[model samples]
Target: MKQIVARGALAGLLAGVVAALVSVLIVERPMRAALVIEDARPAAPGARGGDLFSRPTQVVGGMVAAVVVAVLIGIVFAVVYRWVAERVHRQSAFARSLHLAAVGFAAIVLLPMVKYPGNPPGVGDPDTVDQRTNMYLSLIAAGLVLAVLAHWAYRALAKRNWPGPMRGVVAAGGAIVLAGVALAVWPANPDPIPPDVPAALLWQWRLASLFELAALWAALGVGFGLLVDSSARRWAAGQRAAVAPT
Candidate 1:
């Protein structure tokens, strides 16, 4: 268990580093371009820059933060892998890791994002930050709850003698409907973008943000699976050697 966790963490660290680089290269460059446009606008009297540090400093700081966050997420992934090992019947470490990562991306990213999508900097009203933050967090929590319920529903329905594909279809369909209902009931966020902000820039920035997250998950899933599989093979070889007549 300890070894598994260590390997997972190492994989996560690597993934995070890769993600940070992606952000710096692909995401941040466009963001800075947008910021240049924003800075050209006339500021309200007494309006000041958000950060004390310069752009380069912030970029480096963001990379460091991304790595730290990735390590933490890796630990969580390790723990989840252990938990899922008991409940799921995946035959290989890679399969199990991929499954978990897919489910995670759905629950954590896709679901909530449908309701409250990502926005680029300067897109949101500062006054509504608290309200938006609360709503976003609530949606994420609700999405996770729905994911858990969906898994439980699948398990419960599996106990019945229904055909496998049929059961999956029914379970997944029900979950999707429930998620849709949840989204429908939730209040929509107001469009907070100023008229001066280019729609094209906003669209591209949002896409970049989503891509950054996708990259992180993809890297973590594949990297962790490789590490776990390699470790398992080594352990099996050691065990076989110990048991062999020598």
Candidate 2:
């Protein structure tokens, strides 16, 4: 039990650091570029650059904050992985991890719409509507993709010993369904006019962020799963060694 917990925590911490770095590289950088272009093109731009890129110092600070948050999140995820591995029935740790991740992704997609702050709603009268819808649509697509990928991964791992076409079908099906649902449910956002930033951009960034998170979740799941499995195998080997005697 202690070994599993320790492994999970270590894996989670590693995943968090990697994930934060990936987000900074892939999502933040591009978002910054988009913001810069948008700000430069504006007829009368506000003091705040429309992009995260305009402020390099701020961006770095944001990245640091993100890294810290990711680390904490990683630890929590690790603990959950250990608990689930120990208590789950029938399904392997991999399967449980993937399924839980899918659920987490889905919740993230729905967050802007259903959560406390509500959606961005753009800068319109209905401050919640446009932002909320835009966020939902963008995240839903990404969330579905993540779900499918994770599910297929789980299926593949669960049935690792299986042979031939059966395994292929199972894996493919899992991936497809996981991605399809979220995309289908996503709602589109209206383009923001001059002086007003487009909701689509916000949604796009959010969507990309979700993908970054999905990658982290996948890594953590795989890493923690392998660790737990390895620990169990080692323990079994030790028991065999003891019973056989010197």
Candidate 3:
């Protein structure tokens, strides 16, 4: 378990660095475009506007934030992998890691974005920040609940001797339905997009952000699975060596 966790952390660290690079390369262009709108706003009408740090500093901070968040997610992934090992016993380590990563992305990123897509900085109204935060949190928590139920649905179907492919489709479909239901039930963000924020730029930034996050999770999952699989093979070989007669 300890070794698995260490591997997870290492994978996450590497993945985070990759994500940060993606942010700079892919996400930053759209973000800079949005910042142009911000600069033109009446309140802050200059190049250096609306923050303590310049764009360079903000970019560095964003990279650091990505690394920290990835490490935390890696720790959580390791813990969850332990919990779900029995449920995914037949899958290879790589497959299991990827399946879990998809679940994490769906619950934490996709579901919430269905209703309240992300905005680059300087887009939202300041007055309703609290309301927006609460709404986003509520959706994230609800999405997690739906994921749990989907897992339960898979287990229940398995007991009834359902085919593996059928079980997976059913579980995934049920989760999607539940997410839609949550979107219907949950309140929308109180704050609307500002008039100045262009829809094209908004979506561009959002797509980049989504892709960056998905990349982070994908990298971690693959790296962690490879490390774990290699470790397991080594341990198995050692066990065989121990039992062999001299």
Best by lDDT: 3
Candidate 1 lDDT over 35-149, as tens digits, reads 8777877886998856699899999999999988888888899998988888877358887888778777777888888888887666777888898888888877887788778
| Best-to-worst TM-score order | 3, 1, 2
Tell me the whole-model lDDT of each prediction, alpha carbons only.
0.82, 0.58, 0.86
Give the winner by TM-score.
3
The TM-score, computed over Cα atoms with residue i paired to residue i, of candidate 3 is 0.88
Per-residue CA lDDT of model 2 for 155-210, tens digit only, reads 55666666645665766566556555544565534444345445666566666666
Q: Against the hidden reference, what TM-scores do the models get?
A: 0.87, 0.50, 0.88
Global Cα RMSD, each model: 5.6, 9.6, 6.2
User: What global local distance difference test value does model 3 have?
Assistant: 0.86
Off by over 4 Å in 3: 44-50, 231-246
Backbone clashes counted, model 3: 0
**lDDT leaderboard ranking:** 3, 1, 2
TM-score, structure 1 vs. true? 0.87
Clashes by residue pair, model 2: 35-51, 121-131, 144-179, 148-178
Worst 10 residues of 1 by lDDT: 228-237
lDDT of 3 at 124: 78
Lowest summed lDDT across 10 adjacent residues in model 2 is found at 114-123
Q: Kindly list the per-residue Cα lDDT of model 3 for residues 11-40, writing each as its tens digit.
A: 889889999999999999998998888777
